[model samples]
Target: MKYRRVKPWLVAGGCLLMSACSLAANLNYRALLVGVSGYPGLDAKLQLEGPRNDVTRMRGVLLQRGVPAQNIAVLADGVPGAELPTRANILGQLDRLASTAKPNDYIVLHMAGHGSQQPVSPGSPFARDEPDGLFEIFLPRDVGAWQNLPGGKGGAVQNAIFDHEIRAAVDRMTATGAFVWGIFDSCHSATLVRSAGGSEEVRMRQVSPQDLGVPATAMDRATPRAPAGTVATAATAVAPSSGAGSVAANRGGSAFFYAAQTSEPTPEMRLPAGHPKRTSHGLFSFVMMQALEGGAGMSYRQLSQYVLTRYGGMNETRVTPLFSGTALDSAVMGQDAATVRQWKLTDAKELTVGAGALADLEEGAVLAILPTPISGLSEAIGYVQVSRAELATARIEPVDYAGIPKKTDTELKVGTVGRLVQQAMKFSLSVGVDLQQCTRPCAFDAPLTRLRNAKPGEGVAGAQVQWVAPGQAADVRLTAIGDRLWLMPPTLGGQQACTLRPMALKAACDDQMERSLVSITLGSLASPGNAAQTIGRALHAASRAANLMRIASALASSPTNGQVKTSVAITSKGGRRTAYVAGQVPRLEDGDKLLVTLENTGRVSVDVTALYLDSRYGITAMFPRGLGASNRLESAASDSFELEIHDDTLGLERLAVIAVEAEKQSERADFSYLAQPSLPSETVTRGGNEADGNALFRDAGFAEYATRGGRPAAVSARTGMQVFSWQVVR
Candidate 1:
């Protein structure tokens, strides 16, 4: 095999560490980067601009993180004297890397190019096995060589590399106890393309089976049934070939991060405003690079979430990224002690760490405090609990172990090292909806369903979970239903106590919007495995409570006009009136009259609009509907709007009062690209009837309107709009 090695350079940047320990003494790090930007094939559409740039960018990241100069290898499309990324050359390098790898070593294989699918041969060992009855193939530089090859011919399979071939090599590396990390910045299907920035072209990054000369009969025979919940992409279907068991057996784990879902196309676009370059990059590759630039400790889960957040912010929601393998919770970059950074104590009881939510830090996360310049695998002196967390900083309070001192004997200074010792344990809880609460057609004892966790950066797809109860255990299959995983329980009837348990629940914000709070009784039978039943119950309950608390916090912290107090009044025709104050509203009944009153200070003209989201996730614009009339209330005037609580408005209802300055209303209109006269009519109603509202929410340009905290942005920089939300329990 022919190849060329690129020596890593000492880039001037902060050390990118994954945790608070020194590099492992015995572990070795190696990388194989293949990028094909110039494909000299019959299909001119295969040429891309991102792959070459992606390799350059990733090489820089690895070097900055201190990978040895001699350990990195590269294969680009057009570099003079460099090895070309042909099928043979690429597979040769993969095998070479696997042979060279040893136990406790780290191997990174990054491929950026076109990905396609080919029909499986009839009666073959791999036939009709994958959810999509086609084998996913990566197009090498010589992909066109097999275009005319006859099917059932001996040489046709050699044209492109199949996923099983890649898996086989990965298996070899893992069998040697080496961790194999694969990053594919390509997509395998083009049937569904969601593009941003008004691009007209749908970039699929795939070639159809017909283009590769696969026989129609073979395809027809292998025409795979769209398995009940199978996503459209072959990437998701082919991931399990190198299952978790293979990865777990290796002390060092393996993982794959795909650029897009199987059915969606991954887009390559020029760098956004903040990046220094104007060159294009795969959306996933660009975001992944940014997530790693922090030089702080992060797990695969944390890193994935970080990327998902930034990617969503870009308004590219068509293709959801996919991550599979056994090490979702393992530290990203590598597992060496040197990859972890040391944090410094800020006070006697609290230490300030340079890792927070972005790094997957959560409340109650335990961290080990090690002295600076950790010499070896030294035992931690004491532990700390994360009391407060921000995007990039966390405040930790020292934990007093039975024998360990609360304070370190040596005065802790800034830059002292700390490592995440234990993650806060969480539980997957299953609760039954009260039989009386079911609307109709409800099963006797089905698990209560909440809002699907479909938002970006939330639940994983196809993950397995188990439901356990006294004398009964049923396996649950999870399918991606919309944006979240839908839990499918076995068809068992009758009310029985049960608790849901996954092998692991990656620490993430459970922001599922639900109608009513599902009460979970953590009985003794609800506990599973080694976790204490009481603790499991408490954690599950706390998680649900946290969701409610988050909503309340959003309202309490909303930007307001001075210290004004708002009140709501319920009145009857008999002239009897009951007043309900903001933050203390009583349970509302159907047909109850609602009079919302607020004092408008003389500071600015306040325009108020009432927004409602019902139990079915149907959002409606409740007020200010007529045309040619301003929703604005005069300064220094007390204004009131009358609304009735509709009888059908049952379950959890959310009401948001949006107040914007009348003077900046034009700016708001311009930002949303809607004319001033059409503003009031653009209100969203149930069942997606309001096209304007749907467009506003769907556009990434207006993503800032939705806050990361799961609330609408209370303050708009461009238009000075302030929003306040309240929950109306009916």
Candidate 2:
């Protein structure tokens, strides 16, 4: 069955799809073929009728493909010895024909014109094949002359259409749901024509009875019938000699077929004059017709093979064909063009949405929408939902998609489709947030302060506290507040610290904790100091909270002076918490010991870091892998190292405290957080030049080697966030 282009209608809420079947939803049988036989100078004028016969032969083949005689349009230009039509006229006709097509429509255009080559500028001799690989199509009338004619309209040859223009045309038409098939018979400079099998030599002994839709014995003069053996193999569709194999050539909907590769050229016949009654078309078309007329029921691939067999035995010129294009709905064109005889079109209407109307849809996610049938459109748009998995597959990252526009609502349109569900489905995703700074007193500290008798019931309040390593460098501040300590960075001053570790400096990290909080008040701190506090009361809450028994015990026994230890635990409140201990001990360290704890109640995952303050000195420690994943710590000033606590090494945890041991010397200890935090690792440049996108860490040979080996690489920001993502497709 032949395919037609049909436009669908839009329904309410962009929910309903157009009812009309997509134009390209069927097989293609109709074609508009044009063959030109004009060559101005390279050779003598062509007989005034060769192109006409060529067009006629094409028409016959199309008829065999199931296209009605009236459906195949032929435009023959410059019949032997006749002047060819103007370029403008030829293009104009083509444009008009193309305009009549709809989405889902398949249009095949064949051109068989004389071609030659010359310099791009004047005064240059005829150039058969230009060095840049461009062969020009010559017009009929140039008599062995390289110069323009007296009429200022010399019959000069021009390269076939430019790729840009062709792509532009294809884009415009295909956007409306049409597939264009362009067949070029003229020789291209890059690819030379080669000999092929001719179907004419396959002698036919008798026409099969099944092949006769009409009487086999009474052959129509216009449609020749071949003998038995020849008839069986007559229309063997062969793949293009350019190595393009054919599939079943026919289907219920749109299809495209060509006779040559975009880079190669097709050959033309050398004809004689005097208006002969019978003339051979170009090798490609002639053989193509044999497959159509033979009624062999051969697949496109089979037809190609048949043509190849004939060409191998024939004395005349032989040429092959190529085919490639989209099929609508469920149309399949296997290797044999003749076998492409059926279409599995389901009357079930397929309404589709266009990307244009999908502007309101949420980007970077799968938007599952229920399709509703509209009067004008085949499908309907009813409801839409978003899925993150779909976004990842489509490469729709948060950075790539546009921010949600400030609109009340918008409908996404789905174009024509064969089924209800489509990869292009659209959905709406609304985003909103509530921000809270750590500067404010956390609820947990309120309980601890009350238990410690520090001003009734107030939340955790403190000067500010930040994690730090004893000897390593870092910038962080910590203040005492009631019975609980809190972070006091000016940017987000006075927020309660949830864990003993510092936050992984990232904007997304902040957002993840907007609704989360960490606090230590009285029993909430869960440490030995929480045992019904006395005297100084809430004064030492910051230190007590940091000294959680489990962490304090583990750190004291660690062995390596430079190795840091990190661990995660779940709090009674259902929040996840992290703890850290530095591997180095401080010299002249204060007798005061600072301990802290952190717990996250928010939904997002976070990596913990530490900033230690030693009497105004700052030290930073880092755990690259989130707690539980790895016990390794990538020190601020050292390579990645791991810290583990064995049964015998538990004693090292107590020795980890700088002030704890210093207090044993009977000396007053002092400590204050620093402002500068320790950075995790050395920065690396992707490539030596700006264009190179590969990157690696300092002294990281594996990363560099992988990049040079064409492996994917990503960019890590100073904040430890990935800025750019790379992936190798092949």
| TM-score, per-candidate, Cα-based | 0.47, 0.28
Model 2 misplaced regions, further than 4 Å: 1-30, 39-49, 63-71, 78-85, 117-168, 190-278, 296-306, 315-730
Candidate 1 has an lDDT of 0.49
lDDT (0 to 1) per candidate: 0.49, 0.29
- On residues 74-189, what C-alpha lDDT tens digit does candidate 2 reach at each position? 65664443224445545555566556656546556666554323223223232211223222332322223333345543232232332223333444454455554554444322
Residue-level lDDT of model 1, residues 1-730, one tens digit each, is 1112211111223334432222333567789988888777646655677788788778866775667757778888765445788888989999998787787688888998887666565455654446666667788878864433356432243468887778778877877888778899886654322221122122335555556666555555444433654434444433434345644445457777887665445766555322222456676787787556433455675455445444323323235567666667666654322233344455535567776654445566666776644433356667677777665578877776435667643444455556664443222222221233232443212222221222332221111112233222122222222222222221112211111111011111022112221112222232222112222222222222222222222222223433233456777544569875222213455566768776676576666655443432234555455444456666776666786765343333444455555675353222221111111111111222212333323234334433353323322321222222222333
Model 2, TM vs. native:
0.28
Clashes of 2: 129
